[model samples]
Target: MNFPRSIRWKLQLWYGGLLLLLLAGFGFTAYQLESARQLRHIDEELQQRLPMLVDSQRPIPGDRDRRQFRLSTRDALLFDQTGNESFYYVVWLKHGEPVTRSTTAPEDVPQPKAGDPPNRLRGDVRESFLFPGPGDCVLVGRSIAPDLAGLRQFAWWLCAVGVTVFAAGLAGGGWLIIKALRPIQTISAAAQSIATGDLSQRIQTQDTESELGQLATVLNTTFARLEASFSRQSRFTADAAHELRTPLAVILLQSQNGLAADHLTEEQREAFLATQRAAQRMRRLIESLLTLARLDSGELSDNRAPCELNRVAEETVRLLQPLAAEHGASLTTELAPAHCVGNADELAQVVTNLVGNALVHNRSGVSVHVKVLIEDQHAVLTVRDTGQGIAPADISHLFERFYRVEKARTTAGGHTGLGLAITQAIVTAHGGMIVAESRVGEGTVMTVRLPLALRGADST
Candidate 1:
């Protein structure tokens, strides 16, 4: 059977099961004790009335007076209060023969047999008692129905109370478990925030000796180390990219100059052109790395002035139209006035990167569509392309640095593979998010959402 996997529910099940077992055990024990006590009380009542029954008989002097003696004895015993109809039964036996029985005595009650025990067999609901008398034996019995009924009622009451108590305990225990685990819930929230790039978030620990507290302490230490390591790596990459930029620019310039020289041989000219392309690729790669580093270090200042996203989308489409045409692809734009607070150049770069990716990856005859619109107080930019869609396994890592779907495809275009990564970082810096949706053989859609700027003419 599939059971609840939550700790709180498991605890409640265990607690309720143990409680039910305890209640059942205690209830059974109490019922048995009460039943035995009631039966004993019945036996005692029968014994106490035995003497009165025997004393009512007188010794007979002759056989002729025996009938008279029998009649008087029967009359005396029959009129006794102990022999009431609903309470007790009385029988007098002589020489193994029943002489007189009370009016209330049942006919099924057997005659006292010779050498029978004082309290012999009657039945479950009735108890029998035999007392030796002067030349005779007396038998007394009482119905134990009232006692059995009382025990039954008590058992029912116990069950009701036990069930009520169990329900209360289960509810109260669930509440207590939630309260007790509140710290863990807080820790989980902090961890999620950290995972989402807020490395400054830490769990607030109050009891270092406890398990959750200790776990929080360990996680905080690990996060601190991770943040520091990332900071160092980002700084190194930014410094290296900055240092190589000037040298790469010089190398490209020198190679172009050599190719332009009138004295250069054909083979030498080709070699210089290759060097120029390599240096240009290197420069682009370095610039992309620098941009990522800046985004990671939070060095880019936020531009709170309203920028028209529709205008940026229109301009990017116009600039990339030639490339789309060269690939035999149709480029179209549906630009609506949507304004967001971000750098105009950076937002333009985002549009350029998305449209550029669509034009580059798609085959001839594919159509690329760009749209800018206002959606739920956000500037929504959507770029959709009717091209070969991304593989399921490669979609998730598309924004990772230097990640590409296939090395051959990237090599053919001389792609550095940092375009989407840089694009994502820029969007994130603008307090926006980007989502990519694609299915194999269906095409791809990239959606960017930026918070709308609500101030000044931007609100229009």
Candidate 2:
């Protein structure tokens, strides 16, 4: 059988298995000891009776026949007066043939063979011999049926007690394991909560000397350090983005003034145009970085309001239509009334980023299709592009910050590569999810799902 996955179950199994082995060992030892004790008791009884039986029988008066013997009056009185239910027999033998036997002796009772020891036969029925005179032997046989039955009853009781003990051990061991591992389970639950963006949660330690308590202490320290590190990084990005904004704006304005001046030569105009484009690209990169920093620092609120997703999709398509036309791509939309609870501005940004990526990352004459509908009480927005599809390996990391498909293919557009990452963060803040699917030659499809506003749904 395959082992269990939980530590509690594994501990219970091992403990139960060990207890079973112990019980089995103890039962076997008890059974052997009881059987031996009964046999030893029978042997003692047979030994005591042999001499008396031999003494009781004597040779008949002047009889030369070896088979002739008689019991004394005292021995006959003693044997007949005993009321014990255990059947016993005595026999006198000479030269391996019976000379006399007691009245109650069974004719078929086993006799000792030649060369056998005095106390040879031992079992439920035991036999012992006595040599009192020359060429004369006496054999005593006793039925140990009472003792045998007592031993058998003891064996059954031992088995019953062993089974009861084993069952109790399993239950008690399982409870103890659960109690011992409760701290570890708490730690695991805290770790899961922290992983789901609640870094404020910490493991509470009850006993520092215990292993789980020590682990909790270490994990609490690690989480504190991680939260501080993330805070510092977020602050640094926000500061840098804020610092670069003014300079980029000045650069753009100066380049625009130079381009509009009447005295500028052709070479000068081209240079100024290039400078303006570079400044604009830098500004867009800084803005994306600032948005991500705010998201990380929890400064941007997910303002919950009724948002019509179909309206957002239609606007985003219209806004990106010029870019698609410039690349010889067609923009089409299939919109249904889909309403969700989110910030309209952020949802618009999400649609803009998706549609913009589709249009910019496509070959000429490719079609970009946008769809908005309600599925399973969630607003579903899908953007599909008939462009060069993503590589299989790159699809998983597409939403990761600054990850690009192929360096050469991505270099043509001045993409900062933070679009999908920001889009995912915004969707997650709104309690939604986004997924991307692509094949080598087919195309790419990005699906976004947001929970529908309860009030809007009720009204509908």
For residues 301-411, write the lDDT of model 1, one tens digit per residue.
Answer: 455467799988888789999999888999998989988888888888899889988888777788999999999999999999988898888888988989888821334
The number of residue pairs in model 1 that clash at the backbone is 0
Q: Which candidate's lDDT is highest?
A: 2
List residue ranges in candidate 1 displaced over 4 A: 1-3, 54-59, 63-85, 92-98, 110-124, 131-139, 305-312, 333-344, 371-381, 407-410, 427-433, 449-460
Q: How do the predictions measure up, each by TM-score? A: 0.82, 0.81
lDDT by candidate, in order shown:
0.79, 0.80
> Cα lDDT of model 2 overall?
0.80
Off by over 4 Å in 2: 1-5, 63-85, 90-92, 101-108, 113-137, 142-160, 306-340, 365-388, 407-409, 432-437, 445-460
Model 2 quality (TM-score): 0.81
Candidate 2 lDDT, 219-310, residue by residue in tens: 99999999898889988999999999998989999998888899888999999999998898899899999999987766675556777889
Model 2: worst 10 consecutive residues (lDDT sum): 78-87
Clashes of 2: 0
CA displacement after TM-score superposition, residue 65 of candidate 2 (Å): 7.8
